[model samples]
Target: MSTPNPNPENRQINIIDPAFTLNPQPVYDEVLTRYRVAKTIGLNSPVISRYEDVIWALRHPEIFSSEMDMHVGLGTERPMIPQQLDPPLQTRYRKILDLQFSRARVMEIEPDVRRHANELIDQFVDAGECEFDRDFAIPLPCRAFLRMMGLPQEDLELFLELKNGIIRPPIANPYDIAAAKEYRAKTGKRIYAYFEALIDDREKSPRDDMMTYFTKVELDGKKLTRNEILDICFLFLLGGLDTVTATLGCSVFYLAENPEHRRRLAEDPSLVPAAVEELLRWQTPVTIVPRILKQDWELDGVQMKAGSMVSLLIGAANVDEQEFGAGEGKCVHFERERNRHIAFGAGPHRCLGSHLARMELRVGLEEWHRRIPSYSIKAGETPRVSPGIREVMYLPLVWEKGGAA
Candidate 1:
């Protein structure tokens, strides 16, 4: 367990670009090859890159605080619902929100999810060509989330805009950051207002939806505060909307490029579930999750001072050769068993929406395989990768008539 190198001079620069222009492979290789865990590039934030160390950091939340305000200099600190809070209180919040995403509950919503996917795909399946991101990936999750949250379906475009502004702030220009902040604030206000109305409505007329559940659930023997409910709703919207969109985009891109893998699942729909996990491991839509050091602690021999920010590179960790079988960890092999990936993260703060997200991916892949059985990227057109708070974006593909189905 060698200590992570901390000297700024020794640290590799731009390994984790704020702009996310480069593929993380080189950075991951450097970190894993040399230190297993090393100081981050550019910002010099401490980075835990290996699968095991990253899991350790996630599990020991007391030492690695998820509180957003501690690292205000990096970006705006939106209260991240249960994500930013630690246990006792975090547990309470999780309990209140977990029911909505429970396996049984998500199963109940599967028909609606499948219907939404079909409806979105129906629009472009016959077009012979379509931008997968805008046509299918973007709309599917946004619409599904709106339906689940009981939000107006018409607000999908606005939701996508606001979510992008907040998550992928333009770090290259100060002006962009300012504009993103403004957009985030504006959209957040509208979202909060809507959640407040929903909360009130649920209070007056209880229903079976998640909003109603939140409205009635007690935390620490008392009803959740308006701000708390608002924060939770914000988390739900952000979590539900962003991750699956990127993932669906990646899955579509992968299948388009790998015709054999696509055909395998198309011919046998039962493989969709296993294929979803492998795609998540290979694509890792959510690349990194940042946590602030709660107290002075020693990790892999390096001494980390309290309050220093450390990023758990979930993407890098998932691809660790030590954990997953080798020959570069990026390859997708759906039949591989014992495939435990950290795409959903780990420990207490591990994705609250993991079950629902998995369901969405499974169903989305099934519907995609059924509708668009064979598609390919256009010639001379390379996919544009957009890495931000997460990775994978704007995957464009075209198929011959009836090829997708």
Candidate 2:
């Protein structure tokens, strides 16, 4: 996946760069091949790259704390529940959350996910050309989220506006940090107010939905506080809607360039699950996760301060030859056995929605291949990927009219 870098020591990687988001495997390769702990160019944070080292950091939350004051600008009034906390409080929250997002519960939503995929395809499958991100990548997950949260489908536009306001902030200048923060703070208030109303509505008339469950579910013999429920919903609103969309976009983008791999799935649909996992590892949409050190500790000969931020390069760790193998073309093998990639993180705080995410990715690819099986990137247009999540914000795709071969 990467040409060998003779001078990996001098390699300058900016995780927020379009180049990195477009193709991060080379940077991962270089980091794994040369340095155990590295640093990024633009962000200038210490990076932990090896698979073993990363797993250690993820597992030992006491040494590497997730609790921090980093997300105020992202519209989080408080730490978004569970994700931003460590055990045993985080563990208790997961006990309540796990049931809501279990594999069996997630499977209940599959039919709707499949139906939505086909409906999205129907809109553009006959046109022979479509902007994949706008047409399919964005809405599918948003609709699924609306269903899961028991929100009205017609509010998709407003939801998108709120999400975009917090994420990209809709500022005229991308570098205007002050304006972006101010805009997100305003959006944060809206998110809280909206969810607060939903919590109230659920209290008045409970339904068989996540919001209702949160309203009634007892934790340690008492129902959750309103702030706790609001915090949890806030996490779900941001995480549930964005992650699958980004992963789906990156996966389809991969298949577009690698027609051979795409043909494999089209010819045999059963490979979709494995293909999804492989893409999760290869693409690693949520590129880097940050942790603030709880105490002064040295890792892999790198000295660290107590409050310094450690950027765990799970993206690089996923491709590390130490774990995934070093044989030619084997590190990124789609069908590789014994793959324990941590694209979803590891240990106690592993993604709670992984089951739902897998189901969505699998159904999405299966349906897309079933209908638009032979699409490619539109000529004279390059995919535009965002910096943080590696989302293909502008992915123009084209195929022969009515083509399914």
Candidate 3:
């Protein structure tokens, strides 16, 4: 609740500070430079901010366990499947889950993804201006994944609200424990009920989509329980829908600000793929990932007690000068090479939907620029951006009607 230190050099930062949430890079840069590891305000959890330490902790899940319900007050009885399940049991679910998100599978859907991106663009192209988040970014991934999961597209709005309530609740202060818990508890129950009904339907008459697959897939020679299936659905609903929306919004907002970076990708379409990786590195959406300590551990000489939570600053680590050379002016290089960003994380819990995420970003950027190359942030409008998921809520973009710059 404390005001962010007005002076960047000597100021102490709370990760959940509203100002920090508005724009985190400056604070993260300052913190990582001054103190590689620091503690949160009220939570007091050690936040791992360096590239090497972040990856090291992610790799050693034995010590930094993911099983804990890190969102303490969310009322989750169990961790979401696969990502939260450690090694042995995790390995079992992963074996089947891996095939579902395989490169080949994602590639098979590429054309559909591309088509959907264009379809979205077509809706706002002639207007020459649009609110990028709600119209394009949110729906692009939501509609596509809903089809793949055999869920109704009509429910897109419903899911969007539910997802936001959990991650980006509409409260004066996101770090307000009581408000966040109350919002999450109500939203969580609705989400559970929605998926539970879907599960029941899939059970009676399994269809030809992911929902059916989840119902049929066996683990340890037993069908997944309804709650287990719901957990998987819960993860997919959040992962499948929001991450891409947030990433796409951030990508476009940056590209809008830096016309040269936007022009470079538009001129040479081949660079789109690399641009996706670089953008992801520069504007990592999922910022802090919390891991509970299995036992006493030490990171950068800071001893963490057992059962303590460590927040991994994925956004800060991606821009570490050691890994990626200092970004031009700002800390982003669209052409940076040897970029090993853990934006999706590392170890056994690395994002399963990464390939799909990459494809969506690439296609979304390519199609948007293909239609409107010389775009800029609508003048006089300040976009709303947040830190945790680093999203631009309303990206007002305006461009000339020409195809090329």
Candidate 4:
């Protein structure tokens, strides 16, 4: 459990460090095998990367509290509800949220999801080339979220900008911890302000949307406060826009490179569901999950003190050799059996929109391949990958015009 000098080489690694962002598997490979738990640079928290350890930590949220102060250090003014709350409170908010994103409810929009995916592909399928991220990956998910939230489609660009500002801002230097924190604070305030206006608007002119539901939704016989609603709105806005986009981009990038796999999925549409899980495990967009220690504890011999910050490395854990089998972690196998991936996370705080995410991912892949079956990474172009929230940016794809359709 405890290994003195786990990282004897002292190879500098931080979740946000460029080296870590560009390719994190190497770092994870080293740390996960060397020590189930270890510390890293740039991130003031200890890193837990082993599959079992990460699962243990997530399942036991009481000890490893999710009450992370994500308020940009500007205090309670911009609290991210449910995500930053614990137990009873977190449970209450999640109850209300569960109803809206329930599997049955999300399925009701499957037709629209399919329609939107085709609509976006319609723009570039005939051209024989397109930037997958911009033309397809990005817009499809955002449009679905807008349709679900009943938000104006025109505001997609604005909301996308705001989401990036908080999660992955256009930083001059991503490793600059101080600067990134400051930028997020400013962006978070803008998000808070934006939601406040929406909440106020719905209060006067109620509509049939999630925003209105939050305004009237009650917990323990009391309506959710303005702050609580803002927190929910804030969390939903980010989750709706980013998570699926990240997954779609990663999956498409893989498909572009692996035509064999693409052909199989396109030929056998039923395989798409199984393929989705493997892709999520392989290209986990969410890399770091942060939690604050409630009390001193020793996990697998690693001593962590109370109040310390511990990061459950989901991206690393998903590929852990111990869980996924030796050498298999690196291989993208669509027919992988017993593939228990924590891409959407685990335990009490598992992604509320997971149903919607799975639908969007499946529909996006199914519809695209149904339209354009054969494609590959454009010649001389390589996708740009990031570290912390592992992603494939600007995936340029090309195919023979009318050849595979």
TM-score of each: 0.90, 0.96, 0.90, 0.91
Best by lDDT: 2
Error of 4 at 170 (Å): 4.3
- Superposed model 1: Cα runs more than 4 Å off: 1-9, 13-22, 70-78, 168-175, 326-330
* Model 2 pairs whose backbones collide: none
Compared with the true structure, what per-residue lDDT tens digits does model 3 show for residues 1-47?
A: 12332222233457656677666789778666776767766556777
- What lDDT, from 0 to 1, does candidate 2 have? 0.85
TM-score of 2: 0.96
What's the CA RMSD of model 3 in angstroms? 4.2
Error of 2 at 175 (Å): 0.6
In terms of TM-score, which candidate is stronger, 2 or 4?
2
Candidate 3, superposed: residue stretches over 4 Å from native: 1-11, 169-180, 325-331, 401-405
Model 4 residue runs over 4 Å out of place are 1-12, 17-22, 73-76, 170-186
Q: Give candidate 1's error at residue 395 in angstroms.
A: 1.7
Whole-model lDDT values for every prediction: 0.76, 0.85, 0.79, 0.82
Q: For model 1, how does the per-residue alpha-carbon lDDT over 47-110 read when each residue is reduced to its tens digit?
A: 7788988998889888887875732322223566787788877987788778777888778878
Between prediction 1 and prediction 3, which has the larger lDDT?
A: 3
